[model samples]
Each structure stands twice: as structure tokens, then as C-alpha cells.
Target: MSATLHRLDARHGRAPSLDPMVQLVAGDMNMVNAAILDRMQSQIPLIPELAGHLIAGGGKRMRPMLTLASARLLGYTGNRHYRLAAAVEFIHTATLLHDDVVDGSDLRRGKRTANLIWGNPASVLVGDFLFSRSFELMVEDGSLKVLKILSNASAVIAEGEVNQLTAARRVETSEERYLDIIGAKTAALFAAACRIAAVVAERPEAEEAALDAYGRNLGIAFQLVDDAIDYVSDAGTMGKDAGDDFREGKATLPVILAYARGGPEERVFWKAAMEGHRASDDDFAHAVGLIRSTRAIDDTLARARHYAQRAIDALGGFAAGQAKEAMIEAVEFAVARAY
Candidate 1:
């Protein structure tokens, strides 16, 4: 974590800690990471090489960790969660690869994207391979319910990607539509990841629903902060170039709000920069200025906080413990990235 993040976390009491949760699930997480490494291996050589580059890129593995932590919290003693976590990660990594292609992104997790190092075709094909591998793991688990949840999430994610593609460079995108897009694109997997823990643990239906709700809300808040960070964070801080969203003309929450509040002249600037592809560094700066002036970032963060609180509240039925606390901190961590 950055120093700035530490300060922000400190202000919120001891409610913002991932360490306790990570430590509690450390053994299971290690097994999940090993499974990820083992599953990435193939005779093609290039497959593991390219996939490992992203897998080892030092992400916190937050999604899979959620799966592991959820199972541990629910008192699961079986090994199924490890495999499930690995499968969850595979699904997520596959999406990242394809997303980088669609966005023409060069950086991910602070490293050059595989699509940049290799060609787009290779990156995309490898992503397909990972998706297939994830399904195989799901089959090994021998649960139609788990398969249905993950498969449905994968389909929803694809629909979200298509929605985002169509919405890009169109400033007329509504906040409701934007939320729908992010909810499907990003939150679906999170919801699946957590919900599957209950499936494997054979928990009650109410517990399963609560975990799904927690993951869904956290995922939405995470994306909201991510969009806000794109307008303000630097490559060193966020692992991707600042203003990449603006450059790509992604009509994220901040952009939607700013465009809505802008005057006619400001609207012209927004249209020219976002729709007409006339954005330069200076124009990007000016766009940031306008967004800040409009308090779009503040509004975006406020919306994110609302979801974060919802995520925290979803754990109301679960007893207070290390895992539950970690899950709550994870929600705060998601929102804190924008700081």
C-alpha cells in the first residue's frame, strides 16, 4: 500500500485491514496460488510463459482471496475452495487479457500487457485457453450449480464488455446504464466467486445470498473508484497511465457526471475531446480541471461509499471474526485506491 493509502486508512479506525484476513487464510491462499501455477502449465511453452507474466505481476489476487476467505469464514474444512479459487482467478485473468486487447492497453499490474509483448491474436487465443481451463476445473469439481454460476458470470461479463464498447466515446451514456455495465462486467465474477464458496461449503441459502450480495456491492464500488482513479492517479500509483480512460474516451461515471453538468461551451469541448478524438495532454488536463470543478470525483466517490457500506452491511448475519473483518476491509480497500 502507498503512504497516502495508509493515512486514509488510519482515519477510519482499525476497520481497514487486509492483513488479518490474509493471514487467516494464508495456507489456503498458498494452495490456490499453487493451483493457479500448476494449471497454467502446458506443452505449448508460450502459453505458460505469457500467462505467467500476468499471473506473477504482483496483483493482490483479491478475487481468489475472497473465495478462499469466504470458505474459511464459513468453517469449510475441505480442499474444494482452493480449486474454486484457482478457477475464479483463471476467469478473471482471461477477462483482463481480452479487456486489454479491446482497450489497446499497454500496461497492467505495473507491467507491459501480454498483448503488447506478444500480438493481440496470441493474447486473445491464450485468454480463450485460460477460459477453457477454468471450465475444466469447474467440471472436476463435479457441481452443476458451480458451473452454472461461473458460466453465467462469464456470459454476463462478455455482454458488459460489448455494452462498454458501444458506450465508449458517447457522452450521452446515462449513470444508470453505466452502473448496469460495471455491475455486470466487474461485479458478476465477484458475486460468483463468493457465492461458490457457499455452494462448496453447503451453507444455508441465506448465507449464500448474503455472500453474493457482499461481493456484488464490493465489485461495484471497486469499479467506481477505479474509474475515478483513472482521472487522477499516475502510472506509478495505479499501475496504468493516468487519464487512459479519457484518452480512450470511456464514458465512465466521472465523465458522465461532468458532461451532464457542463455548459454549452464546455459541452463542445467534451464532445470534441471525447467524441471527435481531439484529446491532447493539455486537453486532458483541461478535462480533468472541468471534472474537478464539477465535483465529479467527489460524487463518484460518494456513490462508491454507498456501495461500500452496502457491502459491509451484507455481512450482518456472519459472526464477527478475522475473515468477516478482512472482507469489510476489502471493501474499504477497494474504495481507498482512489485516494
Candidate 2:
């Protein structure tokens, strides 16, 4: 294990939390929130109403926080990051709205999903509106480099969504393919969010690449832990029910690992489950049992720790200070959440 991972694993007494990062960016976040609220408005009442449902809902705003924190790390003192950070959040919120529609998810952040309450078409159209708004913010920023990064990220996220949709309900999906899906879907925006901060700060390309690496690795670790939590956390804790992925037949990392490591009978069960033949409460319980017995969750978490270490190491060029500490702690928090 890397020294950072060892230190993180040794912190059993006090679990890592995003509080430090949140506090670090609190002042900047207020301005970003203002920009978000102002830009999401529309002459059509339904647009803001639906958009606000999820935006006003209690998301941790992690992507925007990364933008602000990265700017802080580069010693940037300008107000440009506030608007760009809001743009990052708009992209993220738009994706969540679309994802809940695609996944047929009923709950998010422990509340009814926008699609469930307002219907799928409304949710989808509002998501489109948010996407347009994000582009407007990017255009207004007037930096082609920033625009390219975020625009490319938006396209990559859409491609990733389609890729994942095509790969859904296949128990034989390989770990490598799964990684590619998540790299585009989740990590693309993370890398763009952090990389754009360096752009606005007029930092060099090396710093931009470093921040991109940090965000990319952290995003992969974050999604891996989230996949693991689907089998371990309840709606109250994770804002979604335990076994939601299993019920939906989504081939997340845990399911992939368990299927790869199972015996003949276990493999049959997995194939049937992914084919939607077995979806009872008892079946989910059995799936969890097989996962535990196979040590899939443990090894999945191990993989997350590996990426989390890389994320921390990516910041090595930055000078040591509160921004660096909070960013490292944020990675720790991402990997620690499944515990």
C-alpha cells in the first residue's frame, strides 16, 4: 500500500469527511450558488421549477467544490472561478437529472426524484435546458480552452451514458470495460472541472494536467465506492436503496467481480439475476451474500484505495497548505464513505 493509503486506513478513529473541503470553499461557493440560481431561471415557470427541484435539493456539490478548491490551490484570487464553478455544477446536475430518468430511479438524496414527481419528459427537457445554460456560461467566459474542455466533457458524458446503456444487464462484462464506462461518464467532468480552474488562473499546462489527473483518479475512486455502497447502504444513508443496482440489473464493479469469481452454481445465479429472472428481496440478499463470500466488495474497495492514492500523489507539485490538505482529505472521504 502507498503511504497515503496506509495513513488513510489507519484513520479508523475519525472517519475522513468533506467538511474540510466544504469549509475551505464555503465563501466561493456562495457566489457560485448565486450564479447557479440566477442562471437557471427562465421565462417558463416549469423550467426553473423542475431545475430547482434537484439543484436546490441537498447534493454535496462536490464537482464545483473541486473547481473552487483547485483555484485556491493555485493561489488564484479572481472571481472568474465562481461562474465557472457554477457551470460545472450545472453540468453535473443536468447529468443527474438525465441519469435518474434513464435508471428509472425514484429517489435521490433521500427525496423523490424530479422525474418521479414531474414525469420523465419534463425531467429530460429541463435537463436539456440546464445543458444549454451550462454552455451559455462557458461561452460567456470567453475562453476557448475552457469552453473546449467543458464542451468535450459534456459530449463524453453523453457517449458514456450510451455506452453504459448498451452494456447494461450483461453479467459477463469485464472489469476493464467497466472502467472505461465510468472514466467517461463520471471522471470526464471531474477532470474538466479541475483542469478549467487552472486555465482561468493562467497556470501552465503542467499544472492543468496534474489537476486533471487528480480529478480523474478521484472520480474513479468515488464511483467505485458508490458502486460498492449500492450493496451495503440503505436509502437513508446513501440516498438510494440497497440493492438498487442489482434490482435494475446494472453490472457494477461488485457484480462484475463476484460473477468473475463465482463457482458454477453461483455463475448460473448471477446470469439469471442479470437477465431479470431473479429479483426478489431474497435474491438481493443472496447476491449480497455471494459478494461477501467472494470478497468482491473488499477487493473493490482495495481498487478504490489504489486510485485514491494516485489522486493524492497527483498534487505533489503544489505547495503544502490548507487547500492541499483539504483536497487530500476529500479523496480520503470519497474512499471512506463505504465504510
Maximum-lDDT candidate: 2
User: CA RMSD for every model?
Assistant: 4.3, 2.3
Give a tens-digit lDDT track for model 1, residues 1-339: 111121223345644556766787888888999999999999999999999999999888888988988897798999988888999999999999999999889988778999999989989999999999999999999999999999999999999999999998998899999999999999999999999999999988998999999899999999999899888946456676788889888889998999999999988888877784757888888998999999999999999998988887788788766677677777878887776
Candidate 2 has what TM-score? 0.96
Error at 285, model 1, angstroms: 0.9
Per-prediction TM-score, please?
A: 0.94, 0.96
Candidate 2 residue lDDT tens string, 1-339? 123333455453577889989999999999999999999999999999999989999999999999999999999998989989999999999999999999999988889999999999998999998998998998998899999999999999999999999989999989998999999999999999999999999999999999999999999999999999988845357776888889899899999999999999999999999989889999999999999999999999999999999898898888888898899989999998887
Clashing residue pairs for model 1: none
| Model 1 worst lDDT window (10 residues) | 1-10
Off by over 4 Å in 2: 1-13, 233-235
